[model samples]
Target chain A: MNDAFILAGIRDVARKHVGWEGPIEPDMRLVEDLSLDSIKLLTLAIEVENRFQICLDPERDHELITVRDLVAAISHQISDTQKPEEENSHRDTEDTE
Target chain B: MNIASVGSALPPHFYDQETLLAALRANWTQRHHNVDRLEALHRNVLVGGRHLALPIEEYDNLKTWGDSNDAWTRVAQDVGETAILRALEKAGLGVDDVDALIFVTVTGVATPSIDARLMNRLHLPPRVKRMPIFGLGCVAGAAGIARAADYVRAYPDQVAVLLSVELCSLTLQRQDLSIPNLIASGLFGDGAAAAVVVGAERRADGPQVIDSRSIFYPDSEEVMGWDISESGFKIVLSAGVPEVVKHYLGRDVDAFLDDHGLSRSDIRSWVSHPGGPKVLTAMEEALELPDGALDVTWNSLRSVGNLSSTSVLMVLEDTMSDHRPEPGSLGLMLAMGPGFCSELVLLRW
Candidate 1:
């Protein structure tokens, strides 16, 4: 998946689910800039997990301060989970050939 | 009427936040989707430690709500007796001096209630009037004091003792995995408190009750409370608690103060309940409080978590003992609870 695609997904969740009217940016702090409270932050976490089909560690949420940090973490989780499936797909393709 | 003394008794079984968190994680790890979410929620409450009415291992044996209520009945009497004794002793009064006994709690129920049960144990006079309040939740601490003050105001020669025993830990629903229950588990604790309110005719070395006000928000029953079931009391906490604080607290407080020819600036001491981090933050923001105004409450929350109705009294005890303000300064004691309501009590030292 593209990083821009992940960023757009995050922006959509923030805007629609979290009710953030302000512009979502990579450097914008979720708490300080976007003004997402703890509940909203939790909602964002769950919605992001469902959207990406990847599990996010809520305990490590403190490490995700900015939108860029969140996007990067989600991207990392997606890539890691997709690796095995991608390898299996390649094996199946080669076997078919 | 004056607040003669405030005394508290915490249960013997104490555990740090990490230990409690570990125990909860172990219990919920199998069923919970993400254990990390539980840990994060617990850490966010910022409670350093809490006292439990029962031993940690003993909790698993509580198979039914009846079992929990039985434990609540046994422990409430002990703590309630001790708290009342301590408060009466501090006020240089005795059981015979207490003309009225008002008990407030929301954690559990007993047929005769804890206050009536304590009458025989504490040797309180048979003639003493008993008022057992149920379902007030956290606001009972401040509201209890206000009621005690009202009692003394009516009698003018009597002493009213208010006892609040909240065993919040016993009400924990192990089967529930909702966010509210998780937060409640992390936030609430177990304790009991008693306050001595003396009539104007009596002499006491403490703050005089100036006035009090109770404001209830209409159509907000779902804001915070307990949903009772055959199993037990499930927590009905809402994330919108902070929002409610932001919306109503400042205006209510300002109007309350204005009625007594005072303003927010006139209150030198703020003795508030330690609801939680978010509620305290919202309170500070709504009231536009000065730096360190609610430091005592914050410290209490960090140390003992929230003891439901007993918490504000613990804060009051701490304030009167360790953080006593100026001799003639004005103070305000406030708390919010399940009624989606706030109670404010003004005091003069």
Candidate 2:
């Protein structure tokens, strides 16, 4: 997934839960500014996980404090998911050759 | 007159957060679709681990409310005895020097109460006036100190002991998987703390109590408290908790400080209850504290989790041991609890 896709997914979740009618920028804090509570954050995580097919690990990425950080995490998870498949495909190609 | 000493104790059984989470998930059953929600809520409480009243495996045997309460009674006395004795030792006094004994807890109930039991276990003097306070919830720590201070203010030569034993784990409802229960299971731990406040005429070289205030918000009882039933204490943790702190904490604190001819900046040390992350953040926002003003509270949360009424006292113990401010510096010890109320105690070291 690209950054825009990740950002859009987060924004959609934020819109549903926070009900804030504003620009979805990169700098907004999920906690300090928007005051998204634990439940809202979880709801957003669930939405992101469904949309991107990525499981969010709250323990590992607890420091994802900002909108920018969250985008990076989603992108990282997507890339991490694709790597093993790519390696397996490359191995299959070598074997066939 | 002064908070002469502080002490804390925990049960031998302590578990890491992940282990407890796994156990809770197992108990709640994997068939529940909302289990992920439990994981999410539990992870965000900022707790690293907690000391439990019983072994993690043994909690499965607590099948009834009576069983849980029985566990509470049995464990409370052990930790309570340890805490009170440590406090007395730090205060350079024996059980006989204590003029009054004030006991506080919300996670357990007993007719004799833990104070009466401790008097017997510790062999305190017969004339030791006993006051057993229940249902104060988290605020009882600061409130207990305030009450003890009030006692010593009247009798200027006596020593008062305020002991708070909160076995939050013992009050956990195993079958209940409400969001509040899940969050509570994550946020609260089991422990006991004791404070020894001696009269001004009786003690020196300690933090003197300048004043204290108990602020009760009218008609907000449902904001945070317990709902007792046949199954035992069910948590009523409203989402409005942070909003409550935002709305009233600043004003109450300001008024209390103003009455004492001080402001937020004049305060040097903050002994605040680590009532999970949201409440602490709300307090920081409302008070507009400098960065790290609540570092001790956050550190306590990470280390031991919220021990209910015992939390603030444990924070006080941390303050006494690690973060002692300069002599004669002003300090504020505060907490909010089940009454949807706050107790603010001003101290000077």
Candidate 3:
């Protein structure tokens, strides 16, 4: 479900900027398949940051090679950061019960 | 050709360095907590003040990037026309006398381009050739001159005009929190500059166009670039920019001078683009210039920050107004930009 949300966000930006008419999937190459230049990639990164409230370092992250890769990475990051909150909420429910 | 004259026009709105810094700090705080270091970095830029097309409060209301681009176009036309008129008047030439027009900018894009707009506005001849160059960024001024010289070299009886209008303030990214964006906000300002380049065989007035060279550094693409985001144009000014200059400019300058059969010591005047405080310092240290060699560049930076493409032209104008290099004397104009490239123009007065 988180992956879907992240993919939706990336697809929205890519479509707006590059006018991609086809389905956006994991293996889609941002530069080659989507015809996204360096400038467009930067724009996509900015949009992703604003939408997901996540910071991504363009230089450090190597797994974010494709559109699917970006979505997966973001989904992983969001889930990792949210797991503690989910556990805390569960603890609160148990105490209330 | 030697810069016959230079004219600069800033918007009416002006703010003192302290006031600007205060506003910046306030903005930074609103975005992130404890931005003391960012404020200090702003102070270290050595910019005293700058002119803005609109008030700071109005920045938020600039609904779309198109709106800001339109505002830049309006200002560009007004100031660009004024500067070009002054340059032509100083050269004792009319619009009809100009055979070619070169407009340089990186801040905004237009369908007809700024040169086409100016051609129609100024009543330039129908056949007046137009070459509008974009993506050169700050190096456009020196590169514009070099390109103009190339045009005149081929047609030695025709005159060319190079106009640079940089409304960098319009490219401000409201949501960006990067250090480069913050520094760019404090560094670049709005301005336009025009130069009239006449061929040696032409009867018009100006210095002779001696030679020019452009050197592109390898694998240095990350030094500086523009990232076009929805927020606007986000600047990618790497911290290594000053280091790049320090590491390469000395050898590049030597190579440039060597090709012209002259040494750095033989050049009388240096017209360098005032990119920023750090950039100016790096160039100074690398070139080992004497005291006051870069006073014009420094003063231009303090007065107008880095006007991007127009910044070097501002220095060229100041040099012409104050120093007026002696006849047969040598002068060098240098500028660097996005390609991590340097454009050097060797001039003889």
* lDDT against true structure, model 3: 0.81
Model 2 TM-score (2 dp): 0.80
What is candidate 3's CA lDDT for residue B104? 95
| Fnat of all models, as shown | 0.07, 0.00, 0.00
Stretches off by above 4 angstroms in model 2 are A1-97
Stretches of candidate 1 above 4 Å error?
A1-53, A57-78, A84-97
Error of 1 at B151 (Å): 0.6
- Report i-RMS for every model: 3.5, 4.7, 7.4
Estimate the TM-score of every prediction.
0.86, 0.80, 0.77
Q: Note the chain A TM-score of all models in turn.
A: 0.91, 0.86, 0.74
Report the CAPRI category for model 2: incorrect
Q: What is the C-alpha lDDT of each candidate?
A: 0.91, 0.87, 0.81
**Tens-digit lDDT track of model 3 for B1-349:** 4455566666777887788787767667665433554565567788888888677677677778888888878888888888889889888889898899999999988878888988889999999999999899989999999999898888878888999998888898866765567778888888888998877676644456688899898887877888887756778876566777899988988998997778999988899999887788889999999998899999988887889989888888878777778978888899999888999998777
What is the per-residue lDDT of model 1 for residues B1-349, given as tens digits with 9 covering 90 to 100? 9999998999999999999998999876655555676687798899999999999999999999999999999999989999999999999998999899999999999988899999989888999999999999999999999999999999999999999999999999998866678788999999999999999999998899999999999988978898988889998876778898999999999999999999999999999999999999999999999999999999999999999899999999999999999999999999999879999999998
